[model samples]
Target chain A: MLKAPALEARARAISKELRCLVCQNESIDESNADLAHDLRVLLRQRLMAGDTDQQAIDFIVKRYGDFVLLKPPVEPATYFLWFGPPAVLIVGAVGALLFVRRRNRVRAEPAPLSAQERQRIDVLLREPN
Target chain B: MRRILFIVPIVLFLAVVTYFFVAMRGGYNPSVVPSAMVGKPVPAFDLPGPPSPPNYAGPPVKLGFTNRDMLGRVVVVNFFASWCVPCRVEHPVLMGLGPSANVPVVGIAYKDKGQDAIGFLNEYGNPYVAIALDESGRTGIDFGVYGVPETYVVDKQGIIRLRHVGPLTAESVAREILPVVRALQVQP
Candidate 1:
């Protein structure tokens, strides 16, 4: 832990962004894994050495790749990961709209029950015993 | 149009099923994260041998190696620990690598006590041409090692070509390690 509270807080913030490679699910800040501890220590050291937050993050990212970041950066390979859900939602919404519109159009007033159909209905009613 | 629309859900369901079927058949293990260091030059660090030399049983040997030592030679760098169970299983395979493969195999004892590493090496027959003690595991972090018993094949230019996670099996030795080392050796 750093002696300076501000620095320590900064360190903690940075650690939260890094995924503990061993634990996979937990951020380095929350992990008890040895690797996570080391990374936490490394992050503090980098901060103390006057590295900007980006530089410190970049240091780990360079070693471990973008997977180390809790939030993956936007890139060509990750376009699907970032946009696929919204794209699916938009497509689904459009499909539902088209479906509902088609249903509404089919149900609309039934062409006022055309005159010929009405007359047939009347004839059938008059023939009933 | 409605007929086609009715089939859409089935088509989507089948697509999802096919995706899973292919992934399952491919033997995908989610835990195996690919190394980010491949194709990059080895991380810079100077690591030393075990603190006390008396534990070693073998003939006197070069204790440590730096990134510079890796240049101009194809070498296999292995990260192992005395406490790591799989490393013991992988030990004999490492022992054979030095002689049968004819390439220098370097060892970095990760986060292990100097004495324990020396003891492990003495008991198992030392396979490393050069051994480095990574007591703090700073070097291991630089190499992006998440676990023990990870192996890397470095090319003559000191760039990391391959990283084998987990204990190396004989099949992996025959397939991944030997082939990469051989290919790197012939390159000028």
Candidate 2:
């Protein structure tokens, strides 16, 4: 067993990032399933072998797909998952803002007087009625 | 324009809800993860142990499969165990593979005790050319087998073409597995 505190802490951090495939909703660190245990052991072995954190993660990701990672890497396949909600929110907010601003601008602006209307106003002013 | 904007959020919400409702109709098994090994060559390692006699019986050809065993033919590799209920459910469908379907099904009994495997096969007929015992689950990890009752369809060139998770039902067999096998066998 790897008893080094630093290694143990790093292993824990890595395990938490991995999803236990048998228990879909839980992380490998928290799962008691055999597959999860196997994964946890593999992660620890990699860490103790002086592999960097990303290297350790890459091993797991290669074995399993991005689905095994709780937070999958942002790629063409998953672009929508990562940026989609924020993109929609920003687009909707900007659209609504533009709409509201245009409406308000229309309400605030005074109507331009036509030539005939100006002439009628002048006549009314002259007659003082 | 402003009225349209006012309805946008509701419209989006309805679309999202409709997607989920339609998706749920296919049924759900959250534990399944798409196998990464699909499209890749068969994992290199000799499957340990030999197929059990009488119950876990099939063609008398081989005891266990190696990387070389998969060449020159389309085959199905089934990961199963006695403990898994779903494996039992799918066993009958698998039994038809060898004699009826003319497709060799390689079995790997994952993390199962040997005698229990024999007992399981004795109770439920086995449809495997050979049943290899993956005692340590290293082979399972190599094959990306996270759950039991997962099946892989390999092409003649030893490339994995399709992965089916969970039990093989008659519906899934006809709809998913059979069509893929038929297509792969033709031409290339």
Highest lDDT: give the candidate number: 1
Worst 10 residues of 1 chain B by lDDT: B52-61
lDDT of 2 by residue, B1-188 (tens): 76996798799899999988887876855556778888988888786664445444335635566867888888888888889999988888887765655678888888887677767878887687667788778888888888888899989998889999889988888888888887877836
- DockQ versus reference, model 2: 0.61
**How many angstroms is residue B127 displaced in model 2 relative to the true structure, after the best TM-score fit?**
1.0
Colliding pairs, model 2:
none
lDDT per residue as tens, model 1, B15-108: 9999999998987778887788999999999988886543445666668778898889999999999999999999988888878889989899
The 10-residue segment with the lowest total lDDT in model 2 chain B:
B50-59
**lDDT tens per residue, model 2, A1-129:** 479998999999989999998878899999999899998898988998899999999887876888989998889999999999999899989978988999999999978999999999999989954
Model 1, residue B15: distance off in Å is 3.7
Highest-DockQ candidate? 1
Name the lDDT value of residue A72 in candidate 2: 83
Worst lDDT run of 10 residues, candidate 1 chain A, spans A106-115
